[model samples]
Target: MSSTELPESVAAAVDPRVSPVRVAEGETLRSVVLPGLTLAVRSRSATAEGAPPALYVHGLGGSSQNWSALMPLLADRVDGEAVDLPGFGDSPPPDDGDYSVTGHARAVIRLLDAGGRGPVHLFGNSLGGSVATCVAAARPDLVRTLTLVSPALPEIRVQRTAWPTALMAVPGMTGLLGRLSRDWTAEQRTRGILALCYGDPSLVSEEELGHAVREMERRLQLPYFWDAMTRSTRGIVNAYTLGGQHGLWRRAERVLAPTLLVYGGRDQLVAYRMARKASAAFRDSRLLTLPDAGHVAMMEYPREVARACRELIDDYDRS
Candidate 1:
């Protein structure tokens, strides 16, 4: 389908004032309630009638705000929408309390099916990346091209710095950490998160940091915050341990869409070494390596990420 064929609601752009990054100068936010999910969707207002539709999914603990920087850059090329998966962002916890990778993928599929936004350009970072892989694999009909940034694909030897997070899957670890860090302020927790998520924390500006701190504060206030984090962390660990058809790596091999995989040399969570394995797993793929980026390259180097995505879209069109 062409860019000008989108429905008015799908093509409508977001109001910039509500954007956390404010980088999405003309972006707007609207709440979408699908079958069992309620998502906070952000989209740019400048998209022309038929701009190709694209959807962004954030990582485990992240919200739709995570795509604030990248969405606007691609506004002219696609009708971009970033979703706050259930239990994250403004969306409430799932009544069923299933935070497995499959559960997340199901939520995404339900939304896409309901909106009839199949064969879209799908983007995901970290945990969201893993979920996107599942979506593209299970329902190739819904995906046109796939882009992954630091996907939480399995690694035999997980990184040392990521151990704490991976350990959250262990029974009682969540309560233990809560007791251990009870005295820590929100700012301290935010700083620690930035240190782990960003290759060079210094790259983030004061304004951005302030916005992030405030967001962290808001997230902490949610009643299901810790439950969601622990359950999702466990889900990722479970995905990593699977070895057959349900395994993430095996699923990655099933993805039929042309894929773009981005990795950061300084990523403390996902090993940069897995870049080659990922490239080999996806039948048709390209890899982009950023030596200075951490886990969130789309946010750290959005221009570069946006450029690569556009190139992928161009290549998909040509094919």
Candidate 2:
């Protein structure tokens, strides 16, 4: 789709009164209001006219900015937009307070339906991966191809490192953790997150760290921050317990789109061993394993991810 093809809702929803979030160079940030949810979308200008449309979804506690490094790289190939899921980034909480995987998927469907941007090259990372999986399975007509980076699919033996995140789903745990961490500085919180998500934290530059720290400071001040995190964590935990046809793995098997699965060897949240299982689950899927990267491989190695995504689209076109 051409850049001009973006719907009026995207242009109309921009509210100057809403506090601005950090947008990368060559990217524009806007709000897209659907019925019950208002999403913050970040768009990278397409390098070529008539490029295929693509949408990106960020992981838990993440925003559209997570795709900053990668979106520009693919601008020549796709008209890319990354969404800040409801209650995260600049968006407020959903009206229904439904943070389930299905709820998130529905929000995405609404955006695509409203914009008439179906059959998009859909991309997801971690929690967004789960959300993207559901979108693909439930609405194949809305997706052309799927690219998942360290998707948070169910694991038979949950990793010990991920226990703390899962525990937030328990009632009162979020409040307790909030109280305990209230004294912590945003810099401290940012550092902790970096340690958990990055394979090598040192690779993040001082400026990037500063940006993260500022974003952390912004999120910490939001009254619903902890609630959004806790409920979304619960959503993932709940998704894992689903069985038979409702399970994420089961849904993975149902997705008709050609898939590209990217796994990070050093990811602390999702197990690296599940890469092979994901490859087997998706009927027509390719796997990209970045042994040196962590959970956010798109951020760590955007060029590689972009190359693989390009190949995924090229292969599909050839087919």
Candidate 3:
């Protein structure tokens, strides 16, 4: 395979215009239809024939675009693919209207199984992190290594700043919040999100923020934008309440793959303290804590995240 070109079959499957601006140097966007859901997958444009495969899962309210920065950085190490979970990005809602953690996990597992991409290096962020945990535990055979960035594991004392987000999952809370903030423009909403997700808002360039606003504007036009967010938010809440072997903590313990846990000290959503808990839960795990990063460390510090991932992969190769 050429370094700059995709296989004829894979090239034909990609839709170059799906997310033109978000596409990285060597990435392609394609749609994958699984048994119960259809997903928009962003993958490396070219890779060595026998390179190991790696799959990325985004958080609630985020799409495949979330991995735009990290995917290309790891392109040389693995055949990377990032999926827009059902009801997010270009993917349509599921037929059954199910958006629980298990539902999301099933969608991921099915895609991996159908594509014959199992035993992959699985990466997930925020809500995606929780879903990845379930997949790694329930079907360890499908994942070779697990990497989570600020996973939304159940917390006894939820952060005060995260309460509003958690509340959106309630039956009528989304509608209420919508009515209250209906006048806010896409730029306004994007700014608010940046504040919550970035440790230092000033670190984001104007061009990047502008692109974010444009993306937010486009998402706002989607009829199911808020629905996906609400349902997924509720799913996280429900997962937090789960007990016994099904709980996220229990699932973490069940994960057999070598794991890498990333946490941002300034993350307002997932508490930084969860990092230690997660490290302890996964038997063979390492933690990467970024004091200056917030919720989306991969975006703010892609080079750092990439270096850590490469180190993990290198260690795996040697072992």
Candidate 4:
């Protein structure tokens, strides 16, 4: 909602704390501290020294690790970094306890401003998609191109499968669910998520599943995990109800960057029908519909997503 620029004093203050997290062979992880926020940034080694900078944002309950499969694929074209929002991944909760879409967008804006990496290719999935939309709209000068994968935008007729997630926004529902699932194992939780998120759960390798389970286990141990999930869920719900200038659709219409919209035919959360509306909202936009992929298209079909992203950048470059 405010300027994308971070104050000089805040930008200069860097917390030295770093948490140990899994990093792929060609990727590295680090911590970034600002005034009231700290973020875990996962970066891939760019194939060239002067490649354009890019930033990736993950969905609710996901970490920077969500982009692990896709970042390396774009290494040749962009110096990629994926951020773990407050209270997700290795990043701790924000001091203000604000998990609103605007809050997350501000965190991202601060990070980019502090790093002096404006006009970067911005990519987001699901809830992160909503954040990216807000960022691009509010600070068009900071975004070069925008890509959204199964963005959780407002829907007129919500899907039955997605209602449960949306319901978490209700007061006390998060604690109730937590108590109900107190006996559930991390593996069980991971499998349930995989089944819900992936169009074809069997496509996930055992190693990948193992990593997910471990991550789930670690998150379950965090004192603020469920709180972050509940508040962020509420944020999305609140964002959907907003109208006028603050509405996500209105913001999408204001985005100036070349946009790429990816929707999964089998997505149980975001409806496939919204793709056309999204394409129409962003003036300069293209759509990619993947019939077999689900919510996390980047993770499920990285190569195809990467190729589409390349086309977006290439087309933007030519024009």
Determine the backbone clash count of candidate 2: 1
Candidate 4 per-residue lDDT over residues 62-123, each given as its tens digit: 99999999999999999999999988987889999999999999999999999898889999
Reference-based TM-score, model 3: 0.92
Clashing pairs in 4: 119-142
Q: What tens digits encode model 1's per-residue C-alpha lDDT throughout 11-81?
A: 21222222232224566666676555666667775466777789899997998789888888888788888
Per-candidate TM-scores read: 0.92, 0.94, 0.92, 0.94
RMSD of model 2 against the true structure: 3.6
Model 2 has an lDDT value of 0.90
Scanning candidate 4 in windows of ten residues, the lowest lDDT window is 5-14
Model 4 misplaced stretches (Cα beyond 4 Å)? 1-19
lDDT value, residue 47 of candidate 4: 98
Rank order (by TM-score, best first) = 2, 4, 3, 1
lDDT-better candidate, 3 vs 4: 4
User: Candidate 2 clashing pairs?
Assistant: 119-142
Return the candidate ranking by lDDT, descending.
4, 2, 3, 1
lDDT of 4 at 312: 96
| Per-residue lDDT over 1-319 for candidate 2, one digit per residue giving the tens place of the 0 to 100 score | 1123233223222343333477677887777767777887888878999988999999999999999999988999899999989899877899999999988998999889888978899999999999999999999999999999999999999889999899999999988988999899999999999999999999999999999998887777677888899999999999999999999999999999999999999999999999999999999999999999999999999999999999998887788
